[model samples]
Target: MLDNAKYDQINPPSRLLMGPGPINADPRVLRAMASQLVGQYDPAMTGYMNEVMALYRGVFKTENPWTLLVDGTSRAGIEAVLLSVIRPGDKVLVPVFGRFGHLLCEIARRCRAEVHIIEAPWGEVFSPDQIEDAVKRVRPRVLLTVQGDTSTTMLQPLEQLGEICRRYDALFYTDATASLGGNALESDAWGLDAVSAGLQKCLGGPSGSAPVTLSARCEAVIRSRKCVEEGIRTAEHRDGDDEMIYSNYFDLGMIMDYWGPERLNHHTEATSMLFAARECARLLLEEGLDAAIERHKLHGGAMLAGIDAMGLEVFGDRRHRMNNVLGVVIPTGLDGEQVRQMMLNDFAIEIGTSFGPLKGKIWRIGTMGYNARKDCVMQTLSALEGVLNRLGFAGPRGAGLQAAWDHYQREQPS
Candidate 1:
């Protein structure tokens, strides 16, 4: 502790974040977080909380009353939902399409659930027919899937699966952290029981807070599992059975009571992060959901065209690609890490590498939120082309930039 006492004066490189997450946050969000902090239970703070809930209601495209911010990252929201809703021996069905699906199964297993997996190969999504058959056979209590799996750049179709889950009397849940602000997702219309997201991806904010919404059904289930904790012990005959809550901190039952009208004390709220989350949702809602989705589509389309013009093969089925991210196969004779490192250190750009079976085989480029603008797209493509050219990949000069410009031109009126 005594050595190296002085902190290094440093400034982070100004990077064009073109990765799967932690994309550049909207400047408005930064300003909001920088605003004066208030006490956790300050009236102003609570008012901000209420406003955040209303704002994210629009972000999720849901009328669900249980929408709010969880006090951690996206994965915390995922675990909160699972730990709250699932009891021991409950049968949970997870459909594996990418790394996140495996994460869901792993979390559910930790909850002591009998987890069943319906899987498709990586870089593909599960068909409705396959899911229907699995749901019918498994008779699971909950059917969970990731709306967008960034690792594979695939969007799982949910329009029909919601009806399937309803018919089977199983709750449907999804983690939309990677897709919410960039794609069209209707939580209420899609019959989603619960959904969770984070601001690090398409929402254009920091990753400390998680935005979550739970349907009335999901809320009711969590409320039913409420337990009296030792900190708030009472002397009403003192004969209650102290059944163990799965996780005290993540207990949605207790959390709901804390956040609901009763306003019981729980952990101190992450006030700054909550402010940031609220502003992120406010920005999206002000922009309009359809417009945000369209922006993502336009920029993502430009990215695809740019990558194609570079003479590199794009991975995954074209018909099912996610609107904000693209997975491109690493060209032959070029080191993927070298390209990624060059983009980061040399050009101040950040793109993603693949995971699991797709690792070292593909590079994931994202066009999302603040980074989905035309300039960002063009700059990324331009830098990428230069990097690729330096590595001996042959392509038409300035082809990627030209293709992206052409796509943008096509979007303009005659």
Candidate 2:
């Protein structure tokens, strides 16, 4: 009870977000969050929840009725699916191409699944043939993979993996947090049984909410688990009953019941986060999904071109790189963190560094969602060139900016 009021007040600057995630939320979404908050059980609040589900359905390009937002970050959605669908001793085949692949394997292990990994080096993606070979041998019950791994800025090919899983009667799950709104993702057409994404990345919203969709097959499995839980709860009145549910919060069965027409209470819904997420989806749908993806492609390509003109080596195969993020090699004799910090502190810009094996050797630049604009792209390149030049890296003055501008001129209608 010592003078708590003595604490200092702090404020953060409004810098441009050009990093991997938690990108600047659109102003429209911010205004939406300012709307009056209603009670959890209020009719208007429940109606908003229904609209959120419908909005994300369009965002995910799926007709699955179970599409809803998880109450945590993107990883929370990942855990929800894994903990609910993966039973003890189930085989989960994870194709490890980057850090997120390791994340999948780790989460699967926590769910008590037998995990098998087919690994590739960082900055590369696995070929469909390699995945097919692993599937043939492992015969896994579930194939857990990532659509985009931001750590290495690589997009794993899933077009054929889904078919392979279907052939083996295995479920296919993907984490699309990095690629969903910025890339081409057809959840239903791609044969994905379940997919999860966060609002912070390409969706241009805050990180507290996660959007997820599950196929009929996934829904059926969750429903079966729900029946087991219900039978156990009322076992005293019924003759045949099942055992207890493992983790309650991660139980998708109960979550589905809460989100479904039953509208039962699970946790107090994060109202502000839901408004942000719904508005994010609305912005994407209004822009047209394909058009939004094309914007990311254009901006990301321009950023890569700018970096190349600056004499920096672009990491990853160009054909496999994700359209929203780029990894560039840290020049010799230059401190990667120093440049990043200078960008943040001096230029009021934010960029990212790598993780695991690629840490300290690469810098990740993002051109995603609201930041995928010509001015944002040009400003980031200009700032980066200034930082690198000051740090003693030899590169032509204004070369990166000129190159990006030239590309933009060429792409303009004649």
After superposing candidate 2, which stretches have Cα over 4 Å from the reference? 1-10, 226-245
Colliding residue pairs in candidate 1:
none
Per-residue lDDT tens digits of candidate 1, residues 87-205?
76889999999999999999998888999998899888988999999999999999989999999999999888889999999999999999999998999998999999999888899
Which digits, one per residue and each the tens of the lDDT, describe model 2 over residues 1-414? 778687656766889999888788889988999988999878898898899999988999999999998899999999999888887688999999999989999999987889999998888899989999999999999999999999999998888887889999899999999999999999888899999999888898888888999999998776665334433456442432222246677788888888878888788888999899889999999999999999999899899889989999999888999999999999989999999999999999999998999999999999998888999999999999999989889998899999898778776545
Model 2 scores a C-alpha lDDT of: 0.89
Candidate 1 local distance difference test against the native? 0.89
- Local distance difference test values of all predictions, in order: 0.89, 0.89
Per-candidate TM-scores read: 0.95, 0.95
Deviation of model 1 at 182, angstroms: 0.4
